[model samples]
Target: MIRNPSWVLRSYPSGMPTVGNWMLEDRPIPEATKGELLAKTLWLSVDPYMRGRISQAKNYATGFGVGDLMSGGGVGEVIKSESPDFKPGDIVVSDYFGWQPFTTIPASSAKLVAATDAPVEASLSFLGMPGLTAYFALLKTGDPKEGETVLISAASGGVGQIAGQIARIKGLDPVAVAGTDAKLEWCKQLGYRECVNHRTSADLVADVAAACPNGVDLFIDNTAGPIHDAAMLNLNTFGRVVVVGTVALADRFDQPDIGLRHLRKTLIARARIEGFLLDDHESEFETAKADLLSWFKQGLFETREDVIEGIEAVPYAFVRMMNGENFGKQLVKL
Candidate 1:
């Protein structure tokens, strides 16, 4: 009997998203089926990648059609269950069901968690897709080693924050870049060896060269504008660049600016720049989830979530995320 609002996309957004772009509706939750659980959503995620979901873009995942419920990742507590796997009061994360107070989830799509003081909300952030994305990019693709220098943009965002911290744990010197003072401070707190402000600095190549005197051995990119252009010029020979995301490109529907001078660097330095999606690493997701849970228990990882309360706030949160107003991961509590 939860009476909460649900947000559904009314139309596709071109640049910045707006409330008009989303339609709010009310609906009743149905009974839980066999091998299913009815959970109350405590927190709902709002990410820039979601913008692509609203449009019928040729994306990695199927786009959410107009009039379909606009859902994202979420952390919820099961209140009713018909599955052997899940009982009452189990915290779980879901990808398809969101923007509401309650949803029915299949046991296969939901993983039960025993909640602790760390907040089950982290299961949707650092301990989930974003964290796994960072882990694989740094360790598997980038292959950063001790004494190596690494560069990361959007260092305060969910993926970049964990990527830099993981790089440090692996004995690499991580040079972090962010847009604001508060974010730079967070990057420092995350144990990044060096920090840079992309907004103030004009000479990113010089800044990256100064911060990473040995030349960047790997680049974990979240922004692909000026910062990427600058960092590519300073890559060490045979360096690796892991392109996990482009917040800037994502805003423009992944149509980033034409060409990269970095291509020359890739050819000359024999550096490899590759992109990846967390979905491609499902086999490793469970392993990463367990490892992240351990890290969270030990306080090895932490992130800021700009949570906008109420399901009606979903559209605004999406707008804010694309506008870069929210820090870390943007989400809504239903």
Candidate 2:
């Protein structure tokens, strides 16, 4: 009998998660049932959003409890199919694949990865949730206009990098706010109009103000903390703010985020701030994927991945990503 090695939540953490919070155990490999497909995971995504899954706070999605299998998005090869929509050897992507080498999922939950020049792992990065998040958040929520200044926080990150490039493609000026000099340099390579190392800036508000002298028209906020304050302080009239991820506040999700209130700045700028979730825009995923692929084929899209090997590294990868240590999309290759 084949055994599946899986990671299960050991205990919830009070602050930053550690490897100690997870346990690896071997279980019998599950067999695909009627209307289900079994797959061998090729790549597993470790995103900032996973922080919420282990927290006691109520998240938009159901939170994982102790003993629950650590779950996230993954790209895999279908090895056993009990559904007509999938067959052995087909590549598929699903959001529910736990931290295991093999998974049995309902056919309805899996999407067949289209054959593209890009690698199969791309289905978990730029061509997957991160790309989709960047796409709709910028175009639909941010409502970017040509020549407008769009400031993106965490600009070298998975979603942030793609968001910056897409803003540039739409003829918008993108100002990147990242943690390290290396990250800022990479943002420059991605064609951001300006880059600011948030870690080195003496006054982030001044830096952001200087970057967008004309005032920011759109703000793609991924790290909501001091960066959020700086962007709000420099927002233009009728500026749009799209709140995607709050990685800066990951450790304090259960605590109140006390900071400078943006009510005055918001009122003065008439800024429109809205939170964005990819799940809310699932109806247009196919459309977004098509557009992203088209841009990629045109050589207008570029992405980076920070990957680790083995399932045991998944927890470490997630912690590294949340710490802003990973360069791009963090993944664990099985």
Candidate 3:
């Protein structure tokens, strides 16, 4: 029997979360039944969105039941299986189970490996929900046109990075806004036409106005708050703003107040601000997967995973991500 270590939600978070809200515990694995696979986790995906899951409020899904195995998404190797569809050695990705060393799941929940040395984590990163989120949000909602200026907040992150690339692919001038100089530099290397450090900009309205002489045509908001307020002020007439995340104020289900100033500007400029859900585009996942895979093959994209080595580190990693300590995709390893 394998000992499965998992991080559980002990209490709901208030404002920024701390390690106290979670606790690590150990459990045992059972033998796989027919049509099931006994999988050993190798990597765990820790994302910022998980903060909402632990809270006692409504989000894309119902809030995770208190004390239920804290689950999101994971990639694992099948060590033993009773299903003919899966062999002893196979990798599967799913939102199946939590921070555990082992989990037994039906073969259907498992997605088979189509590529070798697939880094598996990409199933949870670029090839998974985040990638889909970025793909559809840009093409369907943000809709940047050729030669138009695209400004993305949280530009160095998993979703933001992918969105920036998609903007470039669509022939838009993509400018990324990040928290640090290093992240801004990385954005530039990733082909952003312009990059700015959110930490350094004292007057983001003036800075963005200076950077985009013609004004921003599309704004992809991940870090919403002051950046949002400032960006709306600098938006070109008919600018489209896509609200993907509101990480700037943490995971409060109640929407943040943007004040009348920015609200008035949005209306005056004839701007359209829309919210998006990635799962709504799940029907087009295969299409998104094919295009994203093509980009990967062409060496057009790369991802950073802040993967902690063990289940013991899951709490710390999560707290770190909530406080904006991680630079890219934040995940924990089994």
Candidate 4:
């Protein structure tokens, strides 16, 4: 008699979300039907983008309503399969799995986890959405060139860490801007040419400018707000800005995003700014995944995971990540 316990959205948050916004309920485990697979979740991912999903405001994807299951990405082992493409004991990853221990999803919606020397949990971090986001966003959007300075905000984060490493690999100089001294130290080990602790810096713009003596040619913005302002002020002529996450403004999503305008700097620097979403680059996923896997196996990449155990810890884990307490990719092992 297995039970499927899920975290359900109890209410939308007006500011930062609290555990009160969700309710965990126990239900019967669902059976796999035709063309579907029933899987037991092994690892669950908690990311900043999830903040948007729980919001009442409109997003590119559908938002969850009160009483709906809190959905996210998860890697699980197939316990039962009714589809010809999969069999029992196969491991798969899917975005359709909610905050639950077991899920029954259409086989077409999940992808088989490729064999890797790295832990299967890597499928959710550097080798999955975060890595893919960093890959296409930097290479395609930022368009890095040799010797150029690429400034990365949230440089120690899941996506930011990978982005900075990719920049270094491409012969570009990576300048890291993270919140803590410890995080900046980790970025240095990852090959970043320079590091700035935004939380302690008296003048971030000046610090960023000093780090990128030649001016920033590419800015991979993940935290936005002050980091965005700093990068814009130091952008080089013909530079590019790839907007990723806005974790700094997570609490203000429901309110107007009031901030310093960069229009003047944009015009003066002739810089190109573009927002990125991993979902938009589906056609290039396999190619990017192949490259990431190769780079990872060759010892060219490194990442950290802040993991917690049990289904009951999911909500608190997410809150910790949102508060910048998690060192790297935040995960829940069930």
On lDDT, the leading prediction is 2
Per-residue lDDT for 42-117 in model 3, tens only? 7777776777777766677777666876766778888897877888788888776567778777777778756743
Candidate 3: Cα lDDT at 79: 87
Q: Each candidate: what lDDT?
A: 0.79, 0.91, 0.80, 0.89
Indicate whether candidate 2 or candidate 3 has the larger lDDT: 2
Expressed as tens digits, the lDDT of each residue in 112-157 for candidate 4 is: 9978897999989988889899999999888888999999988888
Candidate no. 3 TM-score: 0.91
- What is the TM-score (0 to 1) of candidate 4? 0.97
Candidate 1 lDDT over 1-334, as tens digits, reads 5575777778887755677888888877757888888888888877656766776668777887788776778888898989888889888887866677887777788876555556777766787767888888888888777879889988878788888878877788889988888888888988998888888888877888888888888899877777887788888899988887767765466354654666677889999989877777888877877776777677777778878888777778878777667788777777
TM-scores of all predicted structures: 0.92, 0.97, 0.91, 0.97
In model 3, how large is the Cα lDDT of residue 284?
Answer: 91
Candidates 1 and 2: which is better by lDDT?
2
How displaced is residue 111 in candidate 2, in Å?
0.3
Question: In model 4, where is the ten-residue run with the lowest total lDDT?
Answer: 250-259
User: Candidate 1 — worst ten consecutive residues by lDDT sum?
Assistant: 250-259
Instruction: Using lDDT as the measure, name the better of candidate 1 and candidate 4.
Output: 4
How much is the lDDT of residue 260 in candidate 2?
A: 93
